[model samples]
Target chain A: MIGAIATAIIQATLVSAVYALIAIGFTMIFGVAGVLNLAHGALLMAGAYVYGIVVMRNIVPSMTYHPAVGVIAGIVVVAILSLLLYELLVRWVEDNVVITFLSTVILAVASTEFLVWIFGGQNIRISLIEGQFALANARVAYYEAIGFAVSWIAIALLWFYVTQTDDGRSILATSMSERGAQLTGVNIRMVRAKTWIIAGALAGLGGMFLGFDSGLSPLMWLNPLAVAFIAVVVGGIGSIKGSVAGAYLIGFIEQITVELIGNGFRGMPTLILLVGFLLFMPQGLFGREFAHE
Target chain B: MPVLQLEDVDVSYGKTQALRNVSLEVEEGEIVGVIGPNGAGKTTMLDSIAGYKEYSGSITYDGTEVSETSSGKLVNDGLVYCTEDRDLFPYFTVHENLQMGAQFRSDDGAVQESFDFVYDLFPRLDERRDQEAQTMSGGEQQMLALGRALMSDPDVLMLDEPTLGLAPVIIDDISEALERLQDEGLTILLVEQNSTFALRHAERLYLLEQGSIELSGTADELRDDDYIRDAYVGVT
Candidate 1:
């Protein structure tokens, strides 16, 4: 029982980290652009598929399913895809965020379905680093631990970048007021395009890590999408710290539900939590400033 | 040649004409004030020069036409517009807000130099360099807005209502800063509801009313006119 509890704690932390990575990207995009991209889930799916393709095609045959490679591939693939999206769709309709969001949804749904048609609906496992280690009486998967650590590192790096650097402060400024940003010579369009790319890369990386944690499947995007939505909504829109906190809150609750009730009931607690947050903290904990402004 | 000149400018928002036949100029190192009631096309005139709104007119700066450039590109050519209202990026630190003013400067050293120069003008910004802009006092934020414009190292700077809502002391501070900028050979075009303040800063002034330039002359001439004083300056 002690071992099971330890394993559960480890699992929750790992899962929360992954969720944070995904949620951070979503929050950044929404916060900066004031666009609720329903298609962010599609970006996640696309990243996982891209990784699966890259590995299967032996583009990097020497590369195994190492967490590092997954992360690198995830970030790179998502960044490229995000750039493509920016050049092709985002720039043309940035003024109409609602339309841009709807267009992204179409893009996501089409791409996801297309990938499913190409890769088949069945699960395809990326072979892990060959072995599992024992922690107490429970067996801890190496890939899982790696996933957890990589996600935390990514989140930390992002927080530092967003809060510390010149470019990051520009993003924070853009989130506050686009006109204000422009009056100060902040090339609002460029800032936004760069934001989309960063958000995509982070989402992609998170998806790749998630694929390693669980075997890739056609419906893979749904889980991350749900978690990201929950995280962003609960954490508050445009608040990075809030997103991270929300991720952990949802993560631990899901773990607790799975361990205590049943795997089938796990989603119920998340739903309840989301509903509760919406009812009580609709702006998400720190979003009150932006709620009316 | 004038530092900035607008010739027969026509600007419209869909079918609504915001500025019609608006022509004006600001000479080098001169503080030109534009005053009018609300909807007098004052903001539109500034917007047209900044490239935020399109206009059918010849806008020339230092003898170069500027109607074709974008707002960002215009800054590169040394045209800076300080918008009305405290439009500082609320989430950014005071230092970052100033840095944004130099976003187009490709030379890192020049950017750094500009930052220092702006800091010299607004030492309060340097004192609270790392604090988020929104948390600052209103006067500090206004100073930040002015400092941000100066950071672009512009040859001509346009200010739109630098003091809208603030304590009387803060207004005096803002007015002093504008005067100092004018004294240091920085050319400026100021738009304001405070006719007294505008007359105080500007050597020459234009009174706008209902999208037209109703009166234009030296500050002393406008101040001496009874009708101008009755309409703009309060009768004390």
Candidate 2:
């Protein structure tokens, strides 16, 4: 029992790293831009499919390339896509909460249709690093460990940029107070644009890992979107740190439930955790002062 | 030309008109004061000038029309507003708050000098440089707000109620700082509830009531007015 618990904890930590990436992007996008971004999962799907198409060379026939090149292409394309979504769509309707919310859901549905048209509804496998290792007496994939490392590195770089650089700090300050940001000459529009770009890169990296862990499907975005939404809410709606903490908490809950109970109950516990947070601690751990003027 | 000018400026909130055809001007190197009753539109006037609220009619600053300019660009171009809300980033330390005031400036030496200038003006901020803004006392937050505005190195500093609620001692410190700022030829547009403070600091004063100017004159000219004494100054 003890060994099983330890193994579960170890696995949970790896799973939480990717969740952190997805939720952090989701929360920051909400905090800064005031957009719920229901299409965040679609961005994730784009990353996986884009990475697969480039790395596998099945679609383009003559485009076989290094996996690293594929990763870069996936991230860049998603970043550009995120920027365009902001400039072309979200910017125009963000002020109307109902319109923006419905529009994002529409975008997500549209992306699914697009993906199904191209890749079909079948789950397609992508080749990844081929190795396994032992952790807490349980066999763990090398891919999971690498994904974990990349997630943390990206998070660390994001943290340093936010705290140590003026341009990056503007995003945080704007999320804190929009009027204050304007008073201090921080360009709110530019800060919001950069936030969407960051969200895209993070979602791409995290979504690519999710596809590698399972298999790529047109609808792979649904579960991860639900996970990101629950994590964001449980961690507090507009906080970046809270989302990270919430992600880990949800990840651990799901992992431990699956470990102790069964595979059929993987996500059942997080639903309960989400409801409990919403009821008792709606602000979560880091939701204090998350509002802006 | 006046450094700042507003002509026939009008503002409305849905159905109610807040300011009706208001006109004002402040020449360079002048401390202009706007004082009014609780419901009077003093802050609204400042808000309109700061681009926080939209208004009709012409507002010119340094030979350019500013009605179309954003609040951020207005601050970047030297029309800085220290809002009544003291909109400091609550989680940021005192030093970080001050750095934000000067973040856009290109001169390192000037920025460093601003840091020194702020610390010298509010030594409380110097002592608590690492303290977060939200944790500080209201008076200290007010001082930090003023200090942050000063960091912008404003050509025209529009301050709204710098001494709203404070101990007399802190107000004295702010008074001394404002006097020194005036001595160094800084233009200030001060909105204050404290009539005495406004009278002492402002060279020219406007008494606003019911969304329009009731009286306007130099400080000496308005000092003996019976209405000014009865309504605002509370002096015999």
Candidate 3:
């Protein structure tokens, strides 16, 4: 029983790290650009597929193929795709939230379909680390442990960038008031583009971890997308710290449920928690009261 | 030649016209004031000049037509406008707000100099530089708004009602700051509902009424004019 509990705890920590990585991008996009980028999931899928191709197909034959290279390539490809998405779709329809939402959702579907065509809809797994370790009667995979460490490091780096960098502060200023930022000579378009790129890179990095842990399928994007969205909503729409907290909250709850009540009932508790938060505290735990349009 | 010139400018909000054929000029090293009652297109004029409002007119700054320029580019060219609403990033501390004002400038030395200049101008802001702008009183916020505008190192500073809700002492402080800024050769275009303050500070004044300039003269000339005294100066 103690071993089972320990395993559940380890699983919860690893899952939370992945969720936080995915959700942090979602929250930042919402906070800075005020758009719910449903295509975020598509970016993750793109990253996973890119990583899969790099590792499995050996895209660069002359160079030694490493898992780290796959991860980096995934991040770079996703970042570029994200910038393209912003320029082609998000920027044009930014003023209209409904249209932006619809366009991104459609894009998500199109990207997933494209992935299905390329990968033949099969679960493709790439083993970055080929071993597991035992701790307190609980076993943890080396890749899973590496993923958790990378997630925390990424989160810390992001936090430092946003809070300590001049460019990042300009983003925060733009988020608060577009006109105010413009008055300060900040180019809003450039800031938004950079934000999309950063968010995409993060989603891409998270995608590599997700792909390593559970393999990749065309439909794999939906699960992470749903969980990340839940994390963003529960933490508060615009708060980065809240996104991390919400990720852990949902992660632990899901793990505990799966351990105690069986895997079939794992999602039920999170759904209940989401509904309770929406009903009682729509602004979320860390979200400020946004101005009404 | 004027440092800034607006000729035959007409601005409209959908169907409602806010400024009709408004023409004005501010020469280099001059403090030009636009004084009028509420709803007389004072703010609209500033908006049009700042490129925030779409207007059909020729607004020339530094001898270049500026109707098509974006506000951010305009700021980079040293045309800064401080809106009436104070439009501050409320969550940012006073110092951060000032830093934001200089965000686009690549010259660190110049940015630091601008910070020192603003801090020297409004010592109160320096005292509470770490405090969030929203927590400050109305007067301090106004000071911050003005200081923030100055941080851009503007060649022409357009102020929209700088003393709208401040105490008398605070108003005097603002007036003194404007005088010092003018003395330092910062060309100003001030719009004010407070005619007395405008009349006292402006070297040249334009009396705006019903979206047009009714009278334009030096401050003393307007002060002594019978129509200006009765209508704007409250001297029956």
Rank order (by DockQ, best first): 3, 2, 1
True contacts kept of each: 0.54, 0.63, 0.87
TM-score, structure 1 vs. true: 0.92
CA shift of A187, model 1, Å: 1.9
Predicted structure 2, TM vs. truth: 0.96
Candidates' lDDT values, in order? Answer: 0.81, 0.89, 0.88
Q: Report how far off residue A287 is in candidate 2 (Å).
A: 2.3
TM-score of each: 0.92, 0.96, 0.94
Candidate 1 lDDT tens digits, B1-236: 88799988888889988888888999989899999888899988998888788888789877777765667777877888888875777767788778777766678888888887777777788899999887898789889989988988888899998887878888887877777787889999999988888888999999988777888999999999887889889785
DockQ of each: 0.55, 0.75, 0.81
Question: What is candidate 3's lDDT per residue for A1-293, written digit by digit as tens?
Answer: 88888899999999899889899999888888999999999898888888877777543345446778888999999999999999988889988999999999999888878877866777877667799999778889998899899999998888787767778888878777778887888888998999899899999988888888888888888888888888988998878888899999999999999988899997889889889989999888886655212
Model 3, span B1-236: residue lDDT tens: 88899999988888888888888999988999999999999988887788778889799888878877788899999999999998898878999999888877889999999999999999999999999998999999999999999999999999999999889999999999998998899999999989899988899999888888889999999999999888887953
Ranking by lDDT: 2, 3, 1
Q: What class would a CAPRI assessor give candidate 3's docking? A: high
Top TM-score: which candidate number? 2
Q: List the residue pairs that clash in candidate 2.
A: none
Q: How much is B45 displaced in model 3, in angstroms?
A: 1.7
* Model 2 CA lDDT for position A69: 89
